[model samples]
Target chain A: MAGGQERILRRRIKSVQATRKITKAMELIAASQIARSQARIAANRPYREGMQRIIREAASADPAAARKMLATPEKVDVAIVLVIVGDRGLSGPYNSSALRAGDRLVHMLQHQGTRVRLFTVGKKAPAFFRFRGLDVEQSFTGFADRPTFADARAVAAALAAPFVAGEVQQVLLVSTRFVSAGSQVVESEQLLPLVMPNDMEVAAPTGLKGYTEFEPEVEQLLTELAPRALESEIFSALLEGAASFHTSQQRAMAAATDNADELGQTLSRIMNRARQDSITTEIMEIVGGAEALRSGK
Target chain B: MASLRVEIVTPESALWTGDATGLMARSSEGQFTILPQHTATVGDVVPGVVRVATSSGEVAFCVHGGYFQVGPGEEPGVTRATVLAGIAERVGDIDVARASRAKETLEAQLASPGDLDDLSRAQLTGALARAELRLRAAQH
Candidate 1:
């Protein structure tokens, strides 16, 4: 029942309350960003789908030539892995999950005796991989939160060079995919050796099938479409990663805010109890002194 | 007179979506114009101006490399023209000064750099072309 103890508890409660405010504000901001990222993803869909459609048509035009060369390579030698994470932290395990998945993939490739070139997007990936003695071939940052098509093209160029030069056999991407508002999963997908969408193959527009002619030869068209397709895929991954990051951050901040609130409540209760005890002790002391004075009289 | 539903979409946003009596686009083969009832076709869009004649007036768009598709719509003899641009800017929204500065910078970079790799040089050339097209579209 010490007055000093009561004051210390009050101060601790005040700090907890202040922290709760910050976490709450961060939660709101992350929530808003999730909505914005979702909108961006929706807007980009038509362009991405259109690119895919064109590539599919070109590939179908001469499946033997285009698919045989562009779709798959016969052997495996060098592999390029692009790992995407968020630039900032406090997003729960969003960055760490993707990095961890990427690390496992890298190690697995190394065990297979394949040379792996690591390219990272976002600040977290480079630092995380570098700390583990992994060499990052290239790193891009400063726009993971809201990536532009130009950023995607730049990244695609870096990834494409090795493959185009016959240096890398395959390209893989690791990132968190935003499945829905409530669910996000870390995944690794193949980027190189383009996998044509099933719908693209099945639903070839019959009317436009042989009528629509390519400016260049279909093989040449496939060559031109490859880079753009890769760019769009990377861009989509970035957009999904950004949305997933925001969703993770919002949830993490909300949980943290709730924990802070609980801590504040517990501290307040303890502080109130201490104050009550101190007051009771003070009143007892006054009563004791009065009793003593009255007894003496 | 029939009209076609036109949509100009970029990755960032949908720049324009409306009905147009006619539209002109530059493809890899050459420049072509689409009037109503154009047959179903798909072509590679080159970087340049895309002009659309709407009910109000003619509007211009600066489009980067993309795809153009004319597909049959729900109604018979009605086609939907979709321009899926990697990047697109409305002529009205174009900042003439900014585009000019960008073009100048790209030109300078393109001229002074023998050290640039072929790929980088080509990218720069493409960017310059896009900037020039933007400026041109803005002017008319």
Candidate 2:
């Protein structure tokens, strides 16, 4: 019995060590992915900033005309909520947090007597909402970890059609915002009706910002620019979501690895104590048999 | 000075930045040239080659539809020209054979008698135009 118990303890230790190895590798992979995603986000910044500047210049060319297109309708009969989450989630609270925020937003919009249409990006959000008995109108997947501009365009196209068709009065986007390497927050922001970039979002270009000669009219220019701006915004958000996912994954994996280490240590200690107890029992048995022989003699 | 500060930027990187005597591009309205102190102009650039004439020499870029902006610079007479392209390739960097092949394939696809939806048709047209532009720039 003692030998059997020792063998079992040894196997358990081996299994724990194997699990620790996997966790350690996962932690490393997540760490490297975080770095790569962060670099991609940085590289994407220039184009996004440039696009914003152009849009701002055009929009300000004639604020009145731009406002006609940009204004959010007062009465929103139906709103579309786009929730972006990760496709594969082991990433801590990244997917769950975004889904929770989206859920709340949907509930709030419904409370206001607005019909909500749900569009989800990433594999997780659709199933999550469906599990909760909510219908997902559209779901896009397969590019959550590394989204391309084409992906953004596809998503924008979906969002644009409803707005253009006068079906969706408002469009809201929920995703994990990658503010910095150290911090990320799940938040929802309005996507449609083209918000004018405030001073905070973009630096006010100096001197004759819209001295631009519009090819046609400012209104036409704005009409053309809106979809491009939407694509850029979505692309940026996707990049941010990828970065945040990696960051959260790295942290979570690191914790798991650490926990595995602690558990392994505790198991080893327990196994050692068990072995010692088994050895003591064997020694006691041997001593009792010897005393029995002595008394019999 | 006739020289203008010309800059071409794509989503990936800044392709070119130099002082050029003139810059030429095509828009929906038609082809236009920009010289120093050209009225702060903004227009849409079509898929084509953007020619920049600099003191050093002439440089061309195959730009896939984007926005072009020109405004006054810090100097008294200098002007800044910014070309923001969705994708841009320097003339030297363009792969001529590949571009020609792409152009041919796109042309074939366009020629095929099929009922393509509006979006795919538009996408194919854009791709064909971009390929043709790249091929032209490469040949030039």
Among these predicted structures, which one has the highest DockQ?
Answer: 1
lDDT of 1 by residue, A1-297 (tens): 388898898889889889999999999999999999999999888778767766666666677766654566666899999999999999999999999999999999999888999999999988899899999999999999999999998999999888889898899999899999999999998899887765545755543434665665677667777888899999999999999999999999999999998999898888888888888988999999999999999
Instruction: For each candidate, report its DockQ versus the true two-chain complex.
Output: 0.57, 0.53
Question: Candidate 1 chain A, which ten residues in sequence have the lowest lDDT sum?
Answer: A203-212
Off-target runs (Cα >4 Å) in candidate 1 are: A199-210, B1-3, B36-40, B74-76, B105-125
Cα shift from native, residue B112, model 2 (Å): 4.7
lDDT of 2 at B85: 78
lDDT of 2 by residue, A1-297 (tens): 767877888898899889889878988998989989988888777678777767777766676776756677899899999999999877899999999999999999999999999999999988899998889999999999988878988999999998988888888899999999899998888889877667522433552454568786777878888888888888889999999998998888888889888988988888888899999998999999999999999
For candidate 1, the clash count comes to 0
Note the B-chain TM-score for every model: 0.86, 0.82
Cα deviation of A110, candidate 1, in Å = 2.4
Share of reference contacts kept by candidate 1: 0.56
TM-score, model 1 to reference: 0.91
